[model samples]
Target: MRVMVLVKATEDSEKGFFRDPATIEMMEAMGRFNDELRDAGILLTGDGLKPSSEGKRIAFDGAGRTVIDGPFAATRELVAGFWLWDVKDVDEAVAWVKRCPNPMPGPSEIEIRPLYEAGDLQ
Candidate 1:
């Protein structure tokens, strides 16, 4: 099974906060976690994203179009980063996600979802 692990963004992330000692420690921990996943043959790909402020959003309504700037607040619910992994099943994906350390200082949340396989549509 394949899964996508979503990392939600926060205000500090959008503003490009400095990477303090704590942040570095957290990143090191995450690196170790990724190593574990790779050693277990689960990790396919993973990466962190640039701040939302560097991104752009476009919306189209019929003949009308609108462009929204970044540093978007709704980003709190948007994906700031992601991880793709191959696992045994949904249960295994969930277990792996549970082992991930929180990225943000506050209540960071990670959403895990299964990817659609070739026969899933059927």
Candidate 2:
């Protein structure tokens, strides 16, 4: 099964602050973790995202469309990064998440969700 691990963004991330020394260390640890995941054949791809302020969103309603600018209002509800994993199951994905280093400073979180496969529609 395929899984996507979502790293939730914080206000600092939304503002695109520079990484502190501790954060840089955390990144290096995360790189090691990624190496392990790759050697284990679970990680397909993963990377951190830039601040939402650098991005844009488009919404559709009926036949009308709207383009929304970024630096989005909901700072706490944005995504900071993600991992695409080909895992045995959700359980395995959970295990991997448990092993991941803190992706942010202070309190942070990563959410794991299963992806829908084309076979599911059959």
Candidate 3:
């Protein structure tokens, strides 16, 4: 099975800032954790996104379409990064996520969701 681990953005992230608990030490720890995932052979890919100011959105209303740019207002709801993993099941993914270090300063969150495979729609 495949799963996505979504790292939610913090206010600092929206401001293009990396601070406090997100110090160099934390980055190094994350590197070690990523290495662990790689060694386990479950880490397919992962990435960290830049600030929301660098992003844009497309909106559609019937035949009408409009483009909206960022920085988006909701900081906590924005995604900062993602990790794709191939795992046995959601339970295994949860177990792996539980081992990850805190990815931001103060309070932060990571959401895990299972992905749909070809067989699932059939």
Candidate 4:
């Protein structure tokens, strides 16, 4: 199965905390973790995102589409980064997440969700 592992954004992440000198160790740790995933042939693609302030949102309703600027209000609701991984099952993905370094300066969350294959629609 394929899974998208989302690294949920925190206030510190939204403010670019990972770029801080104090978090260098954490960044290094995360790099090592990614290398492990790649070495295992589990990693498909992954990268961290810039702050929401540099992003934009598009809202649609019926025939109308609205473009919203970012730095969105919700902190915990945002995604700071993500990994596209091909794993044997959700449990395997969960196991990988358990080994990930903390992506934030403080408490953070990583959500793993399975992607639906086209055959599911049959």
lDDT by residue (32-111, candidate 2, tens digit) is 99999999999999888999888999999999899987878776688999999999999999988998888887788899
- Kindly give the number of clashing pairs for every candidate: 0, 0, 0, 0
Predict model 3's lDDT versus the native: 0.90
Q: Could you tell me which residue pairs clash in candidate 1?
A: none
Worst 10 residues of 1 by lDDT: 10-19
TM-score of each: 0.88, 0.93, 0.92, 0.94
In TM-score terms, candidate 1 sits at 0.88
- Model 1 residue 60 lDDT score: 92
RMSD (Cα, Å) of candidate 1? 1.7
Mind giving the per-residue lDDT tens digits that candidate 4 earns over 10-85?
8988887545675898889999999999999999999999899989999999999999998999889999999999
**Top lDDT prediction, candidate number:** 4
After superposing candidate 3, which stretches have Cα over 4 Å from the reference? 17-22
Ranking by lDDT: 4, 3, 2, 1
**Candidate with better lDDT, 2 vs 3:** 3
On TM-score, the candidate that comes out on top is 4
Rank order by TM-score, top first? 4, 2, 3, 1
In candidate 4, stretches whose alpha carbon ends up further than 4 angstroms from where it belongs are none
Against the true structure, what is every candidate's RMSD? Answer: 1.7, 1.2, 1.7, 1.2
